[model samples]
Target: MHIHKKLVSLITLSLVLLNTTACSQRIGALNDTLKLAFIGDKDVKLSTQQVNDIPYASIYAQIGDMSQVFIVLVFAEPKVSLTQVPTTLSTELKWLSADKGMIVTVNGRLVRTHNNPTGDLVAVESTEPDPIMLGLQLASTPKTWTRIIDWQPGYHFGYRATSYFNLVGQEKILINDIPTQALHYSETVLVDDLNIQYQNEFWLTPETGNVIKSRQKIAPNLPFIDISLLKPFAS
Candidate 1:
């Protein structure tokens, strides 16, 4: 579809693509799909009952001021869902829109992205396990790690970066208007080569160590993306 038409479709429907066991079949009609009506309204809130009625796993994603609910569309060009990556500690979650815009995350961290208007984060590599995958603990001290990141549209690649993770204590947060307690952690990433530095935050379930919400900036030029799990793909 043309870029302009795709944008119109997205704005009109406000729904992400769909996913099922079979990756080849087209989903139901767009009008029948559940709509994500609140795009850029920060004051918008959803009830737990409203989220529970949705049959598919979903997430609330905000890039800059616009927010939308994206589903796990396995039929996406790259094709993936909540699954373990073989020989790796990271599990991948691929969020794609009707327009084929994709955001690939591992252990709730933005690792790769495609079809982003501000240029995509092509890849992220790390020699050591990410602190997020290790699970942040209350008694844990500050930790640091490094990564090699790549970007596209300008063929920017192999930029070295460092990140520091520090526990900020337990806090109460609301998801879908339901109050819950979570462990909060702060991360600071510094990319000397690109002369860039940014802060990322994560709120995880204290018992399971699963990330419930996060705000991350994968690259210097990219907008800080905020994600909140509305319907968990995991059992």
Candidate 2:
């Protein structure tokens, strides 16, 4: 039976999170301090109380365009040439707590309720996670680097912190009241048995020091996961 793309994608994305977030601080950058995160620009004012008094649960954060997009894409696009989505101040995404499990909803509609082992706890609006379909069944898979590029601090950049499907990720960052850069990161993991690789790019606003947007793509030609931040209001 042919599986629906949505289900496949979400499952894959789910698996990706499991492998990517489990690394400890000593293992690599996947730590509480330097987590593989995409917090928004530090310059913007954020609404941190949409759910509990503490910054918990998923959020519909609004991404302001006043900031700038990361520059890693400019350096790596020539090699991967994946999609580069725009950076909107406010977009569609379930912002979860930096730690612990989170429940997501929009306009009072349930979205997702899962805990990211890496500390990020939110899910997209029915988009398939990007690993199950790509054959990232285990985190101890072999991998290769298609290209190496430099990313100016603040924008996004992709690097292999592990051997799993190389992670192609990004982040939008704003430092100290200015749209400093976009923190983009991506890693392409290679599982020999599957013969497929993953290329993902995330867009986040450093102004808020949180991931405002994220996108992912599979090899040979497949649709990518596009996520953006939505404005959070009193619930």
Give the top-scoring candidate (lDDT).
1
Mind giving the per-residue lDDT tens digits that candidate 2 earns over 1-235? 1234423433443333445344333322222211212234332232323112222122222222223211100000111113222221122223333322243333222223344222221222112222321223234423332322212222323321212343343433433223435545444444343455555544433243244445433122223334434333322
Candidate 2 lDDT for residue 3 = 30
Q: Which runs in model 2 stand beyond 4 Å of their true positions?
A: 1-180, 205-209, 218-222, 232-235
What is the per-residue lDDT of model 1 for residues 1-235, given as tens digits with 9 covering 90 to 100?
A: 4546645756533333332443324334332333343333333355666566645566777677664545443322332222323344445677766556778776678888887777788877765666777777634633887878888777788888899888898999987677889999999899998788899999999987778899998587778888888777753
What TM-score does prediction 2 earn? 0.26
Model 2 alpha-carbon miss at residue 162, Å:
6.8
Error of 1 at 131 (Å): 1.0
What is the lDDT, from 0 to 100, of the residue 29 in candidate 2? Answer: 20
- List all candidate RMSDs to the true structure: 5.2, 19.2
- CA lDDT, every model vs. true structure: 0.68, 0.30
TM-score of 1: 0.77
